[model samples]
Target chain A: MEKNRNRVIIASIVIGIVLVVNILPFLWLVLTSLKTRLDIFAIPPKFIFDPTLKNYVSAFTKRDFLPMFYNSLIIAVSSTLLSLVVGTLGAYSLARFKIFGDKHISFWILSTRMFPPIVLVIPFFIMATQMGLHDSRFLMVIVYTTFNLPFVVWIMRSFFEDLPFDLEKAAMVDGYSRWDAFWKVALPLSAPGLFTTAILCFIFSWNEFLFANVLTAANAKTVPVGIRGLVTSRAIEWGEIAAVGTLQVLPVLIFTFAAQRYIIRGLTLGAVKG
Target chain B: MARVILQNAWKKYGKVEAVKGINLEIKDGEFVSLLGPSGCGKTSTLRMIAGLEAITSGEIYFDDQLVNNLDPGERNIAMAFESYALYPPMTVYENIAFPLHAAKLPETEIKERVGRIAEILELTDVLNKYPRGLSGGHQQRISLARALVRDADVYLLDEPISHLDTKMRNRMRAELKRIHSELQKTMIYVTHDQIEALAMADRIVVMNFGVIQQIGSPQEIYFQPQNLFTADFVGEPPMNFIDCRVKIGQGTLLISFDDSVFKLQNKEKVEKVANFENHEAQDFVLGVRPFYFGISKSITDSERETNFLRGEIFAVEPLGDSKIVHVKSGKNHLLVEADSRFMGQPDETIFLIPDAGHLHLFHKKTEEALF
Candidate 1:
């Protein structure tokens, strides 16, 4: 009993330190977002001060942050949905059928994700310019989908493989076609995995800055690009930057928390057999 | 209902032949069992019949129509998987109704069929519960209910109740037999349990090493096995095999093993042994089931003068209704099913009398039954 109590105390102390370390910066950012310009630059950082919404007001009015936010939402949502639809079908095919050279093909798909994004950015920039597709939300969506498709295929393939093959066979024997078996039985059973994959894809696309920075300009600027725009050469608008950063993190936070239950189960699903 | 026929059915999983060429005809409304040990290709044969697997090079016919190119759905079959593959997201009621819904039946009819099968399977109370949290037995019954709720040409059940407790398994066996009788649909049941095959199937197909060992009625399989594998695999306290040599002397044949000799008094058996005498191989296996052996505590002069063999008791297992006595004689060990009141001690002298009419003889080299 005594040893357990001491272990609990040590564990709680360690967890407390981890929580503070991770959350402290986000808390400070939110605080700075609500502060005056001078208060943001205050020495020692004021713990208690009257907060103002001027930074947020200027962010929406003068910075054209609303359109940028809309651009990010459109690109992220569209790209995530597109990747899921294509990746799920490919993953199920790989999981169920006897494809020739299946291991090599799957490895090739994963190898696409292994290439550093910076290496591809140059070629992508040239292609976008040559095709006159630069500075468009369509280009952004396509780029994000290409990058996220490999991850979706890899994760969803394992999820499909973990399912008992008998379910689909039973469904087919019960008057369902192969497609119907996959849609009605396999897809529904993998709901948790689908949600988990969707959230991760959405977050990856939402916070992406490098590809958006090179491929997008005035009309297609996402939240991250807009936040970078706040760092001007003459004087950095720290307050506005903090405001945009808080707003940028809000949607991802909501998405992750909403799918928190499925995320936990989906992440640890294949560790134990039912 | 349809008459299912397989003409030289074979299944090959890339170079490894899971089911060698097999031919069978299952009449409409007949309950046939494919019985074998694991990896004997019994399950693969059932899957091929269900159209969930493709035959390597053979023809399958349903009611005289070739169904080689048909899909599983097009074959109009219902199968209960060994894995109890109930949809995790659907409730028991929905799972049972899925096939009916796929058939485009009326909602009222779907509900009625699902409800009746669930009640019959004792799954009515768990109709609204998902499959993930149910017990294994409950999940298994739900799979059975789903398969039975549909109107299909054939019902393929692959070890549906193999995971249930003994009492439940017996009860399900009776229930399934009754259901087959009522529905009058061709059903192919697959199981590794010999008792299940014997108790339920009208005809049992015993398989070994991807080949059919024997196909016969339960009584024929029990009393008149055609091969050593069938005789050895079918019995509960399994048949004891004693290696013996056939010695023909003075127009009478005597079977000798170790220091014991017994007369082959049956005229037909004697003729069968005489036919094999020209092969230059005198070794044969004598098979006798436990129930066919009579145990005596002491050998009488008349008993010793006939078919009795001397042995010493190894152990005794009392099973409430009968006791199984393990006896060791020379180089052979045998089991005798004695009466419940019979008391025997280990290392005590015992004599086992073989019923001459029930003995089986198989060639030791060929493993084929001689009579």
Candidate 2:
């Protein structure tokens, strides 16, 4: 009994340290966002101070940050939804049917992301300019999809494989066409996987800045680009940058909050037999 | 109801033939079981009939209509899987109503059908529960109800009761037979258990190694097996096969084994075997079911004359209803099903009487019964 109590104390201490390590930066960001510019530059940082919404107002009114936020939302939601629809079908086919060289095909799809995204930025920029589609939300969605599709397919394929073929076969034998079987039986059972894949794809596309920075000048800038825009040659807007950082996490947080229940179930879906 | 027929149907997975050419005719409203050991292609054959698998080489017909190209849904069949395969997200009612919903039936009609089947399966109380919360037996009932709700032409059940406990399995077996008669659909069941096939099927097709060993009624398959495999496979303790030499002397056929001789009384039964071994002594095997042989503690005068086996009791296996006494004669161990009250200890000398009418002769080399 004594040993267990000691172990419990040690475990809680370790967990407390981890929680502080992770939450401290976010707490600092929130504090910085609310601080006045004069207070931000103070030699010793002030943990307790009068907070303000002035930085948020400046970010929205003076810097025109709403369009960037809107662009991130449209791009993330559109690319994630599109990737899921296409990837799920591809994944189900790869899981159930014996397509020739299918394993190699799926391997190639995942391998597309191995190279650094920097190598493709130049080519994407050149193509966008030639097509006259540069600095537009359309190009962002398309580029984001290119990176997110493979991940969606990779994640959803294992989910489909985890389901027993008997489920679909039973549906088919019960007077359902093969397509109906997939749509009704297999698809609904993969709800957890879909939510997980969608959240991951949305987060990746939401936070992406390298391609957004290189490809867009002003019109299709995302929040990450907008945050970088707070830094200028004349002066660095530290308060506005911190404010943007704080705002950038809201949509992702909402998306996750809406799907939080499925996330836990999704991770452990195949760990036990149904 | 429809009759399902497979004409030389086969299934090949790349280079391995899982099901060789199989021809079976399942009559309308008949219950036929495909019985075999695991890896013997019984499930493969059933899947082919259900259109879940494509026939590698032959054609399948449903009541005179060629159905080899029809999709499983178009074939209008219901199947109960061994894993149950109940939709986990749906409640029992919704799961049972799924097929009717897919058929675009009216909501009231779907509800009525689901309710009726659930009542029959005794699942009405738990109709709102998801599959994950139900016990194994209840989940199985829901699975069966889901398949039965639709008025399909045929029902295919693949080892549906193989996972249940013994008590539950016996109950389900009776329940299934009652349901089959009530529905009168052409049902093709698949199982690796001979007892299930014998108890439930109107006809049993025994298979082994991708080939059909025998196809017959339960009584015919039990009493008159055409080969050694069927004889050994269809019994609980299985039939006893004893090696012996056959001789015809003075117009009388006798089988000799380890200083024991049994005179063949049924001449026509042993005539073919006697004719096959003309002019020379030949090695043959005699097979008899344990139930047919009687054990005596002391050799009587009639047993000493002919058809008497003197051996020592090797082991006694007491089943609840009966006992199986293992007797060793020379190098062969024979099983004798005796009355439960017949007490005998191991290593006690005993005599086993082989009834000539129940004896079976097989050619040692070919393993084919000589009748």
Candidate 3:
């Protein structure tokens, strides 16, 4: 009985430590966002400081706030939708069919995500300039797609992997063409998986900094770029930064929470077929 | 409605041949099961017929028309998946109605078709429910209904009812057989379970290592097994094999194992085993069914020269319909099924006689049948 009690206490302590480790950073972010300037920079750190919405107001007003929000929204939603459509199809083929250049194709796709974004940004900047597509939301959408497409294919391929090919065949025999079968039978069945990948792609596009800063000038600067440009010599505008950062991170946090089940499932789908 | 014929079909995965050259004829309205163990190419053969898998070489024909390169849609073959792939987002009614809707049928006709299929599959009440809300068995029924909702030339079921519970599997097997009879369309079923294969198949195509081992009626395969594999694979408790050698005599052949010798009833049939003895003399395994063995007291001693053996009972199992008695004779274990009323005791000395007519001789080297 003593041994069992000791084990139970140890397990609870370990669990508590783990829970605190995961939640502490998020707690700090929320607290800092709510704290006033004096309390935020208090000598020993203020644990029970009075909270205010001033930082949020400062953040939104100081950054070209609505445009930044709009830019991020447009880029995230458009790129996510585009990648979902193209990536689902590409992933289906990767999971199901035999392509002529399968090795080069898959390797090329995966390599897009492996190289440092800075390396691609140079060529991307030149190409966009040459093509007369600079600071344009359209160019950003396309760039974000390139950034997210590989991940979309890689993740969604695993989702498609969990499904049986017989469903498509069954649909075909039921008087549907291959395209029809994919659209009707396979697509709807794989919605949760697609939703997960879509959310991931959207979040990645929303939070991107290097490309957003390099490519956009004024009209198309997303939230991340806008927040990073908030540095000043006289005052650093901590409250505004926090508020805008909250705006920048909230959708992703909500999306991550909303689609977490499918994300976990998508991660496991690659191994679950067996 | 159609006959599916595979003429020298092949499927090669890189250098590993999953399905070798094979010819099969699935007659219209025939439920032919491709029965084999895992990795035996049974599912590959079914997939080839369904056009889901591309044949590496040779031709597939539907009603004498070559359909080798045709897509699954063109082949018009309905199939049920083992995973029970139902659209998670769609209602059961919408799912079942999808095929008909794709055909560009009128709304009323689609509704009628969906209703009829739902009724048949007992999924009528759950028509508005999504697949996630349904039980596994109900999902299976919905999957099957979705497959059957469309009018296809052939129904290719790949382990359709394998995942159901014992009671449900048996019930679904009977239902499938009934559906085949009612529809009168070419039906090719594939399964690894011998009971399911035997229960629903008009003919069983036994495959092994990408090759067709045997193709015959269920009874033929059950009784006249082509090889030791079939004998072992087709039975409930499975056919028992005993290592024995044949000793020649004057006019009559003697099969000897340890201190026992049994006379062959059909000299001509046993003579066919002469070819195997030349090469597989030391590699011979005699196959016998459980029901073929009887106690010496049950018959006259003088007439027991056919296949009688002296052994002692090691264990007795009462299985309601029959009693399975384990015999330990000359360092070998043998299974003998006797009447449920068998008054036998463990460790009792008994003379067991195997029916010569039911005994199968096999070449252990190639695991092929000798007689």
Give the clash count for each candidate.
Answer: 0, 0, 1
* Candidate 3 TM-score, true structure as reference: 0.82
Residues B1-371, candidate 2: write the lDDT tens digits: 99999899999999999999998888999999999889999999989888999989999999999999888999889888888988887888888998898789999999888998888888999999877877888888888888888898999889988877899888888988998999899998999889999999999999998889899999988998988889999998899998888877665777777787778756686567656945255668889999989899998786678778889999999998899999998888899999999899899999888777888878777778885
Worst 10 residues of 1 chain A by lDDT: A265-274
Mind giving the per-residue lDDT tens digits that candidate 3 earns over A155-243?
77876777767667667767788898788767766777887788878878888999989998997888888777777768776667777
Every candidate's lDDT:
0.90, 0.88, 0.81
Q: Please give each candidate's TM-score.
A: 0.98, 0.97, 0.82
Which of the numbered candidates is closest to the native, going by highest DockQ?
A: 2
- DockQ order, best first, reads 2, 1, 3
DockQ of each: 0.62, 0.67, 0.40
RMSD of each: 1.5, 1.7, 4.7
Q: Cα lDDT for residue A151, model 3? A: 91
**TM-score of predicted chain A against the true chain A, for each candidate:** 0.96, 0.96, 0.89
Ranked candidates (lDDT, high to low) = 1, 2, 3
Q: Give the alpha carbon lDDT tens digit for every residue of B1-371 in model 3.
A: 89888899999988989999999988888888999999999888888887777899989899979988787777777777777766666788987887777778899988988898888778889999877767778878887887787787888787887767888887888888888888888888888999889888899999999999999999999999989888999987788788878755664656777877777747686567654447435667888898887774455657564567778889988899988888888878988888988877787888887777888887777888877
Q: What are the fnat scores of the candidates, in the order listed?
A: 0.75, 0.79, 0.62
Better of 1 and 2 by TM-score: 1
CAPRI verdict (incorrect, acceptable, medium, high) for model 1: medium
- Deviating ranges (above 4 Å) for candidate 1: A266-274, B277-280
Angstrom error at residue B93, model 3: 3.6
